[model samples]
Target: MSSMTAPHPIDDQWDRFRSTLADASQLLLCLDFDGTLAPIVEEPDEASPTPENEAALASLVSASAVSTAIVSGRALADVRDRIDGPKTYAGNHGLELSRHGLVAVHPVARKRTSRLEAVCTALETVLEPVPNCRIENKRLTGTVHVRSVPRRLRPVVRRHTHAVVDRFGNDALEVSTGKRIFEIGPSIPWGKGNAVALIAADLPSETVPIYIGDDVTDESAFRIVEPDGIGIRVGGDEPSAASCRVESPTEVATVLDWLGSVGVDLLESDTSELSSVDTSSFE
Candidate 1:
């Protein structure tokens, strides 16, 4: 996990990353939905991609050499509805996936749906007193969002939430933490890493995979594409498996913009060096 930050237009580290993208025959561009594409809002339902990011993503998706996918913690249908361009999506932390117009849910996760419902039901009862604590039951998985909860009572929310989930036992469900949320899902080994690899499997062997995300849950994905592919962590100086780090979703949009413009040039036989791209404006 070599962490580097950009303080100028385009640093040497970015140039190297661009070089890799320039030489690739094909690219599988995968991104996490919430913090990666859209701003993480207090109300989860309100989160959507910024106009610039959305348009840049549309450009990448329209490219002949790029295949785009959104891998998210949101439910498959939910993320698909929120993001309209990408035909491939992995939701519920990869418990459900839609690719090539076919939808698949992990068999174990499907079977555990009833148990998850029961857990959520119990959680709602115990968490009712916590202000602004949202319990989202996404069928295959669930989340207890405490981002808007009063800071002083957040511990109470976590304690009560875990107590209810503990009653269900580890075999039936598991808990994972993110920025300010606790995700409760079917107890399984599958995650974003497995989901990314599964999606990459269908691509050409030479296709370079680029995954950008901003969550602890996304670490699995960062590790999955290491050594060869690129893993970019967004908005943190925290130690990560990601090879590169960017400050915000705004910078992410710049990266996407560069890919759409410069990438097209390189692919179409234009070998001219990319002019210095001013990233300082984004900061």
Candidate 2:
């Protein structure tokens, strides 16, 4: 595990990463939503990308050297609705992929569809009594977020949440911890790692990857990049997966800004080209 804070600003690292693309034409850029791109809002629905971020991401997506995708724990519909789908989006922890106008589909996750759906359904009962708690069913996973739960009731919510997922049989489902949520999905062997693998295979990057994320799930991505790539973990952990650590969302934005200015040479870029790569026919 490396530090979440880059040895230098993100732009510096991004410049280094971009240099690797000098000879390469293909590029795969995968970003996690929520804590990564946008500030984490108390209410999930209120979470929207800021104007600056929207512009930056729009530019990033359009970059000639890269094909960007937002891989998130969110559902296909939620991600679609949130990001206003068009670009590549892997929802439900990469179980589903939606590109441009294409319909969402779960290729790597369909195998465990039945198990995951069943678990989500059962969890509703357990969480029904938890005050202010919400069970988000993503078709491929169940997100039990206590963001809106009163602070005093958080413990009760957590206990009940764990017990509900436990009833599904641990092996059949993957229970993950998040900022203020418990994400349960098919015990499928995937996460941000699958997203990275998908992008790496498509981009043909020989320089490996440099992934920056601020979540436990991002660790899976850190593991995949390995010696070939750089893993930057945001926040902290005992044996962190990130090579560098950055403290807050504001810091992340700073890194992105730097990347655009010097790293990716994207400060004065346009989204016309990136949007031209019609992902509409893909799902």
Candidate 3:
């Protein structure tokens, strides 16, 4: 599907979102960790949510009717440890998921771990000469970070990284790019959308899903949530499946602040100003 030509700013539609929030019985809030909850850093290991954002997340998590999940490209444990409030975490673009005392790994991706590791090993050797490149092997997936590489040499990194993955991947893995990184994971239909849909399935049928993210990888979830739920894109004006947009992670924190505060009031309130809006449309 095509993205909106000019998505409305999130604040402009905050009233509409509140209307939906009031109509729904539960809220499923899905967020992308890096670049959404936290600022994008050159060193991924140092990334963490701002205190304001983390506190807001904790506020949302404290509500029984609100279920929060962190979906990211990092490993499941990696993203899970980065944030403390979300009860659910989906990582490696949904190849691995943990929620409700249950953990699931895509069977195909799990089986390809050896091949993924091999490809990462090859990528490390091939990309070594490239300055500021980082290769990560996340068991079920791999990534080549070129965010800090010299702009002139980025194409070289892409070419070399692709060649290595193609040569050793042997049809077992596929490559996708987002923000300045190459994601090498199992060749499957699974993605952030599928993971989100799966997680939503476990929530109450009346739950309204709201996904906020800032990268290309998060687009899949945007597509999934746009039909009946809310899809908010962070930091870009580019065409996106997301219907709402914000300026940056700082703004995202503001949205969370409103969500955590206004959300509690709406969910707990007995009346809604827009109650006449067709609730059937949400189904």
lDDT tens per residue, model 1, 1-283: 3333322223346676667766766778899989989988999999999898999999999887788999999999899888889878999988888887778889999999998999999889889888898999999999999999999998898888778888874568888889999999877799999989988887656678889999988888888887588888887666787877777888899889988888655543432222233424322
Better of 1 and 3 by lDDT: 3
Model 2 lowest lDDT segment of ten: 266-275
Q: Rank the candidates by lDDT, best first.
A: 3, 1, 2
Number of the candidate with higher lDDT, 2 or 3: 3
For each candidate in the order shown, give its overall lDDT on alpha carbons: 0.83, 0.65, 0.86
Candidate 2 residue 227 Cα shift, in angstroms, is: 3.8
Clashes by residue pair, model 3: none
RMSD of each: 7.7, 4.8, 5.1
TM-score of each: 0.89, 0.77, 0.92
Which model scores highest in lDDT? Answer: 3
Candidate 3 lDDT over 69-161, as tens digits, reads 999998998888889978789998998889767788899998899999899998888889999999999999888999999999999988987
TM-score, model 1 to reference? 0.89
